[model samples]
Target chain A: MSALLAIEGLRAGYGETEVLRGLDLVVNAGEIVTVLGSNGVGKSTLNRTLSGVLRARAGAIRFDGAPIERESCAAIVACGLIHVPEGRRVFPNLSVRENLDLGSYARGKPRRAQNRERVFSIFPRLRERASQYAGTLSGGEQQMLAIGRGLMAEPKLLILDEPSLGLSPLLVEELFGLIKRIHADGVSVLLVEQNVVQSLEVADRAYILAEGQFAMSGPAGQIAADPELKRTYLGL
Target chain B: MLSPVILIPVLLNGLMTGAVYALIALGLTLIYGVLHIINFAHGAMLTAAMFACYFAFKTLGIDPYLSLFVLAPVFFALGYVLQRFVIGPASHGEDRNMLLVTLGLAVVIENALLVNFRGDTRTIDVPYAFATINLGFTFLAVPRLVGFVAVFVVAIALWLIMSLTDTGRAIRAVAKEKLGAQLQGIDVPHIYAVTFGLGTACVAIAACLLMPSYYVNPGAGNAFVLVAFTIVVLGGMGSVPGALIGGLTIGVVESLCSLFLGDSLGQVGIFLIFIAVLLVRPQGLFGAKA
Candidate 1:
């Protein structure tokens, strides 16, 4: 299948400090491609670069057949390449429903009402607290709202940055299940995470990033079963 | 001893003054709330609008009330351009720098007006400027009453727009979280410009309304701007309704002080109340705790 997102020689960083150096990555259509990394491995940086929040210093990023390296963040979102950023950056002052409503501000505005219903159905808890401020939600619920908001954009490629972070084990399992279900519905997901075992279980293809480079890449099963990767990286 | 005969007119006059203060302070508070910068040049903007309204009246033979239709959109566009070119760039820099820039703009505008219009006080003498309406108990100046009613109308209209519209929601969202709003595809810069324009529009309305009763001069804005700042702080820095309440309260206090104490000490009375309020409720009446 043709790639839904393709990046080559991707280099991005903060002032005077390089984080992502000469990286190449791809996510094909209708697949959950997991990018696994530990702390300070530049996974979040890659997500920022892809979402156009951080400008790529040197790279070519083709998303759904258009070069998006120079695209503004809003333009990238208009292309249905939605990024549910790290830390559940939900508008704390806004009600849950308002946050979801804003997800379609750039794209899918015409079907905002219908998409809101779809999001509420997927996240029944959001519907329950629809009128409550997003800041009042518990951590797990906030995470759900973030993903629900991403879904509101009708994302063709949803880039989730560390969705499993700070969730309880039960919630983590539930989140993985939710990802799998979302993927099954014909949406491509670029899952950037630290939860190796759970991420590997659901992702069709996986890449382990270390020191700003893809240290390993293959089918999910192969990466999970590789004894060397297990002993060294996964610590299984 | 307070006579009801003497007190009634003082109270009404206080309210009328408060209405004008509230109108001006509303713009200041709104700009401060969203931009996170107290626009010191707000007074200058008001002064500029006063000049614009005056010229429209003098040159085009437009009534001050009718001139609003032209002045409002013109001021709004000017505000957008100012934010896009001047304020937007300085916004990303230090807050102190933004403050200095606005202060400089104020000086520049005030001096420019002085250079052109000179120091003479100019007032638009409409036919009804000195006319009064008998309210049974006491007579109210027709111009003041019109301005008083117009203030409430503008305030209510602004409240509805902020609460009911999609654009308002985007604006509020941007104020709450810029990055989150951007992720949702809100153009932050565009919103900022619109908000700045809205703030300037409020000033335009105030300028038009004031032209009926008040005189316009280069320093006219300076006189009101200080009172507007006090009202904003009293009401809660960013609260629209707060500005109204604050303005009224200050107006009543000023009137009462002028009645009992003296006209010169009226401001002293306002300062005393302001300091007392700050001591008790630093966030102002409506401001949420930071």
Candidate 2:
């Protein structure tokens, strides 16, 4: 199987300080690949660079066999590369239904109604509170709404950034289950997460990022079983 | 002592003045809502539109109302270019810089008009300038009535566009959350340009409507700008309906104060109400608390 997204020598950062340096990664079709890293390990930066929110300082990023290194964020989204950003940046003023409708502003506009129905089916709680303002939702519900909004775009590759950050343990398990279900629907997911064991359980392959580069990479089960990795990063 | 019969004409005149004020405030509020910038150049843009209509009347003998077709597109294009070239880059910078840039733009445009039109007051002498509509109880100036009706039509059109169209949804999305809009593949810079264009178009329409009754000068917008600001603040910074209500309220207040307190102190009453609104409900009558 060929890769859906390929990045090589990716370098990105804020002004005068580099976060990601010479990072190389690949996400293949029909797989869940988690980039596990602690806070400030450039995981968010990676997602930002890939989504074209931040300009890649120096790198080549190819999505779906085309170089998108110079593409605008909107253009990248038009190609079905959707990013559910960190901190659930849902439009607080807009209703749940309006937020989901806006998700199809670019790629899924033609099928907005159909995609909205699909998202509503997937997240029935969102459907129940469709008219409620997004800001009024609980943290877990907000996360679900964010993901559901991303799904409204009909993304080929969905990049989730710290989706389980503020959710409770029970909600985290449900979110992981939802991620697994999403994968089953044939969407490629790049799960940038800190939830080690849970992410390992769901991801087909895992890469541990440290100091702006991959420290260890292998099958999920292998990484989870490694005594050194469990002791050092996972804290198991 | 003012008689109760005089109150009727004062109220009718207030409504007419309020309609024009609503048009100006709507443009200011819409631009502020979407762009997150208090556009100081809005008044200058209105002045530019007035001048454009004036020139069209002088050269082509086009009636002020008919000149809307020509002026709206021109001002819209000017606004688009202004946003794209001047405001877009500065938008991402400091709020202070955006404020200063718009202020500077206002100065430049005002002075340009002063140089071109030589600060002389100009008014289009339409045949119905002094015509009055008799409603048995009150008399309505023909131009003012037209402007009053036009304000409702424009307001309804804007509300419909915002609620019904895809482009309007995208604009609202951007105003609410810009990053989310971009993630949805919205060209945010393009949206900004279009929104600025729409705001300018509103001013163009206002200028055309006011041509018959109001004089056009380089500084004509200065007085209206102060009132527009008051209306937008009173209506809420970004609320369309709020602007209309605020405008009407100010108009009535101005008329009543001028009647009872004398013309010299009319604005004093407006300033007091403005201060009271700020002290009591800083969000304005219709504004959502931020």
Best by lDDT: 2
Candidate 1 residue runs with Cα over 4 Å from true position: A230-236, B91-96
Task: For candidate 2, give the lDDT of residue A114.
Answer: 91
The clash numbers for all candidates, in the given order, read 0, 0
Worst 10 residues of 1 chain A by lDDT: A227-236
Q: State the lDDT at A59 in candidate 2.
A: 82
Candidate 1 overall Cα lDDT vs. reference? 0.88
Expressed as tens digits, the lDDT of each residue in A1-236 for candidate 2 is 99999999999999999999888888998889999999988999999899998899998999999999899998999898999999888988788998898888777889989989988888899999999999899999999999999998898999999999999999999999999998898899999999998999999999899878888889999999988786557545
Candidate 2 CAPRI-style tier: medium
Query: What are the lDDT figures for the candidates, one per model?
Result: 0.88, 0.89
Q: Which ten residues in a row have the lowest lDDT in candidate 2 chain B?
A: B90-99
**Lowest summed lDDT over 10 consecutive residues: which window, candidate 1 chain B?**
B90-99
